[model samples]
Target chain A: MNIAEALKRTFPMKDLSQGKAASIFASVKSKMPAFVLKNNAPYRAVMTMDDYEILEWAHEYRLTHPGVVWAESLKWESEEDKDDHIALFNRLEATKNSGSLGGKELLDAVQKLAAQQ
Target chain B: MAEVDGRILDAVGRFAELSFLRMKPEALLADLQCLFELYGDSFEEVMDGVVKALKDIAQDRVTVSPMKYDLSQYSCYHFQSVVEQGQPADMRSLFKRAEDGTLEVEMIGNRFFPADIYTRATERIEYYLGDIGNMSE
Candidate 1:
């Protein structure tokens, strides 16, 4: 299920103290899920180790393949330049997300794009 | 008058010179705070010696001011030095006492260099003051 559904199923959206939140996480850690917690203010999510690992892996992937990640995406001059870069990025993202592209392939794709400009 | 350690004075002189030459204010303040922490129980005495030594070397170029903030948990001191001749190159250092009783110092102004230079300068300062064995990182 989605994060919202998972959170709703797990815990009530109420005034949860830091201590209560810790206890809740401790109780349900075996499921390795994510849940939302609030303390009379803004809501925050407490992610399980497995979910955190996934996020860490995604972060590492973005760092390794900056061109494919939107935040670390390339800067382009003109609208046409941006379009070209986005098109190259799309292809790179597809290959990357599919797990079909290795480090060498990713580098080759980036190098090929650079060579074009 | 209790004599200040000659070696400590020498290190301070070298540190001040290097700070002026390299133009790294943040590093200078950070190192200064670290230097104060090194002296531990002799903080007040060491600081008194430092002020005297800096005044002797820097002449009219240095100024020290006591500062107090409503939100701060401890006493604060401000130090400023005009290190360069032209274009008004000045660096200000603010030292606030931490809850643990050690002073925490931060730099103000002198924004020409990148952040990485400050980090490297900190490392260099630690090495320079290596004999004291209070170098953090």
Candidate 2:
């Protein structure tokens, strides 16, 4: 499939509507199929090396930004602390699904506590 | 001097055997990489040479082959199947028919039974009564 066709088929993003010819050119360069789906669900579309390189550059930029939690989350403060954090998240998820508490209240409490951290 | 050389060869052979028996997956990968770098060969070719080298170094060395996965084909043939064990039937003859392999089956009546007969009987019984063990639940 062509890039335009693939983008139309897969991506829900509205910004990709840059006319058909340009999309076809992009698809030709990426060597990725014009469409990609796994088990009838959209998986990933192929991209040109240039497009991938640009994405990699953007990823690096985000990783280097102090405000982004991607880098911070990868760091392990302590195994015990990591275990405790996971346990807390699991407990919160269980509480949310239990139907005994207000979801907005629980979420607001989590957001407030997370904001402090 | 020849006797001494033979003794040295024997010791070398023993050490090589021990080393081969003890080789791990990671070390084999490293060795294969080195062979590829030095020989300017394809990975499989390098891996084959490395296997030979390992065998020469020690007897019975284990090797882990690389795996390749490609996910591009969209129209490939696929299949689905499910195996289910049927509840025990109330009749021994149906069970015996199932055990004889005349039918694709389920267990019923303390014996094996073909699926068609079991299903027909089950539907008939369920139609008469709301369910098989209606009041039990």
Candidate 3:
């Protein structure tokens, strides 16, 4: 069932005062059960402990692995250095002829080379 | 004008400290509105009391100001707390005069959470308050 429909069946929105809301949230959390509120209200969703843990893990994973598009948008301290970084990447591509490497792999290789010098 | 009592002052001080430390926006706003309800007809007195109480507790760590907007018929109080080891945070309370001269107070902004947490908390508070408002209508 949809969240709204599920919530309506479990908790009625009309009787949800601020105090009642807090109490309901605490109860739902302690009970470790998923509940849908009669509305799409924020801070009112209560999920199972496992579901919450999964959500947190997914968030951490996204932060660590932000994908290629986000990694490409990262900035350097200086505009000149940013251009130098791009130039260095071009040189690396020519020298290694490693065009097949992904963006992160290429970045790692560039960083490794810079560390050596 | 009735002078604000010490008990009320103490309560306001505690509320400010909590708002500056760990209280979420919704809870903070709810507590602040409760204070207004408790103070009854002494809106200005309560505002002054809270400012003084915050200043006393914050001391050199913060600055408190009372501002009035003549065009909007609103009175606002602001406090910016400086963190010795991290980024500072600000809290603003606005009292808008209603049709019958009763002021409706709303406490908004962040005083403790980091930028990212504050942004997320604000979004949630806005959505929750919007839902509540809609339901009332």
Ten-residue segment with the worst summed lDDT in candidate 3 chain A?
A: A66-75
Q: Model 3: which residue pairs collide?
A: A7-A36
Instruction: Report, for all candidates in order, the number of backbone clashes.
Output: 0, 8, 1
Q: Which is superior by lDDT, 2 or 3?
A: 3
Winner on TM-score between 1 and 2 is 1
lDDT of model number 2: 0.31
Among incorrect, acceptable, medium and high, the docking class of model 1 is: incorrect
Cα error, candidate 2, residue B49 (Å): 75
What's the distance in Å from true for residue A5, model 1? 18
By the TM-score metric, which is better: model 2 or model 3?
A: 3
What DockQ do the predictions score, one after another?
0.02, 0.01, 0.01
**What TM-score would every model get versus the actual structure?**
0.24, 0.18, 0.22
Candidate 3 local lDDT, A17-75, one digit each (tens): 64576665665543354354555553355666877888788767644433221223323
Tell me how far the alpha carbon of residue B13 in candidate 3 is from the true structure, in angstroms, after superposition: 9.4
**Candidate 1 vs 3: which has more TM-score:** 1
True-structure RMSD, every candidate: 19.9, 30.2, 23.7
